[model samples]
Target: MYTIGQVAKFLGVSRDTLKYYEEKELVKPKYDDENGYRKYNPYDIHDVITTNFYRELDIEIKKIQEIKQSKSVTDLEHVLAEQEAKILEELAYKKRLLKKIKSVKEDYYKIKEHLGEFTITEMKPLEVKGEITEYAAYEEYETIRNSTENLKKAVTLTSARRVIHFDEEGMKEERFIVVRKIEDADKNFKGEVLSHPKCIYTVIEDGRFVNGEKSIDHEVGERLLKIAQDNGYELTGMAYINILLTTYEEGLERVFLEMYAPIK
Candidate 1:
């Protein structure tokens, strides 16, 4: 027989935890009234070790107590197997989250590198030839690209292409593209492109827009607009972004926008 403190020292558990196990009937120890101290026998030591093993496997305290009372090996094995499966599933989830976090960090560093190198300039509107179309809500570049591909198949001019995005009524209402000729504009382009008068635009330094990181475009554009306003430039006309490529294959390119302003 060993006192509670002696048992705790041997098992490396606190006396309070052993007391809790006793209250839960997982480990019943003898008590001595003379000292008002609890005493643990050899059988109690074995129970404590088994309870700790179950706890290490993350078995719930209630389940552990039930298992101990039943003394069923098959039931204990089932609980342990469930705990192992849960641990593996959680590990897989953590791995995926870590991968995403790494990818995001890499993108952030890349954008930071480009920020210091890019230049912003006010640009005069120029004629762009491409098919024009209306854009619906949440329409993305990939959808626009598919539309452009279909337009190319229908048109004879291989070189003419440009997409213009415009906002209307608090919604993304219109998309316009300039192709080689009017004869090439058709339903296949997915929307009608009416001639938009040339407006002032801003030009971003070449190699500013990165592929697989288009979200940076919005950040850059917003920052440029703030800079323009700070310089007392009145933003008046539609903004057009012109992407000039140095290496499309490597996603190294410059994007500049032409923002129109009323002559003050």
Candidate 2:
């Protein structure tokens, strides 16, 4: 026989926890009328130890009770097998989550390295791999990306919008590019393929100077033209703006973006 406190100390559990188990009918402690307290016998202590062992496996209290009440070996085996399956499933989920987290963290660091730098550089022509959402609104972009279920969870907002038109009522219709960086161009892409030549690429950050007025794409393009002329590089082809960073919550006001224009 043992008091609740004595058993709790031995099992490394609180008296309150043992009391809770008793309340849940998982353990029925003998009540001493003369002492006016709960008394745990050898059997009760064994039940508590068994309960604690199951709890270590993160098995639900009710499920642990069910396992304890199981009479036949087959019944016990069935419960154990179910728990094993659940643990395996949980392990797989956690592994995937960890991999995704690591990838996103790496992306954050990579993007951080590109911040606050403006220079003329030559970038390899990237293949527009994914199915581009043509003339999509911000909401439409989200709906389309969410449908695909391939968007990185850590990534927010989306890719560049080939701003065709913008008025007081916001964007009428604009092409949105879900840029997929790939070595070989995937031929399955249904969207229009527009690749940048090995030309001057200038980046512009979204700040007070740049906002969605007459399309930041045009603004950056014009600025790139000046840069090209000043640096003795001929400014020819149309500009392609690349959205670096943004949030769905922060419309145009608190959004972070960059413009990439092809210069001769």
Candidate 3:
């Protein structure tokens, strides 16, 4: 028979840990009443080793207790299966997170490379919905905040400027809007889809905020229009502004946006 100290040393665990296992009734060593001491036989040592094995696998103490008391192999198999399923789900989530990290890093590099540079390019197809005229409570806002899938597919907050309208005079209208990517597979989707064949694309920085609310600087709009006129591109009275990145510096929110002004 071995003492608690000898068992703990052999198992690479602390005596308190062995005492905790005793308290949990996971391993009950024989007690020497005359000597006022505990004694662990080889059988008790084997139990401690098995308990450590289950712990290394991250099995909870309660679950390990259940496993110890289980009479059939089926019961043990069921617990193992549950742990396996949970691990697989976590692994899949981490893989998706890694993919998103790589994509966002690439976008940051693109923003740095193309800031303030203008080029005529085709805009990606967009699906437009309701307009956000002012700051107030709305159903779409709540849905996007609460639903994970909808939030993931919400383009307006991540990559797209809600909406921008330009007429012959200049930028006529600008406001936030509820918008998402057009799903080709969804037959039920009936939102208006827009496509621009040619557009003057450029990235602009805006950091102006009014009354703690986000607002776009109109000067950027004038500059874009002037660039189009100077380059001899006929205006199409509309433009699409997409967001590339947003950052906070010195308590100020700065937005980096990509604009696509349609040209004839």
**Rank ordering of all candidates by TM-score, starting from the highest:** 3, 2, 1
lDDT of 1 at 104: 47
lDDT of 1 at 166: 29
Better of 2 and 3 by TM-score: 3
Cα lDDT tens digits, model 3, 25-108, are 899999999996789999999999999988887889999999999899999999889888978977787785776567568768
Which has the greatest lDDT?
A: 3
Better of 1 and 2 by TM-score: 2
How do the candidates rank by lDDT, highest first? 3, 2, 1
Model 3 poorest ten-residue lDDT run:
143-152
How accurate locally is residue 115 in candidate 1, as Cα lDDT from 0 to 100?
Answer: 37
Give me the displacement of residue 77 in model 2, in angstroms.
3.4
lDDT of 1 by residue, 1-264 (tens): 899989999989998999998988889888898997888889989999999988887788998877867767898788878889999987776775675457446534534454344333333222333343432222443344443323322321222233323222221223444432234333333333434443233334433354444444344435444655666654442344433222344455544332232222
Best-matching candidate per TM-score: 3
| Deviation (Å) of 104 in candidate 2 | 3.7
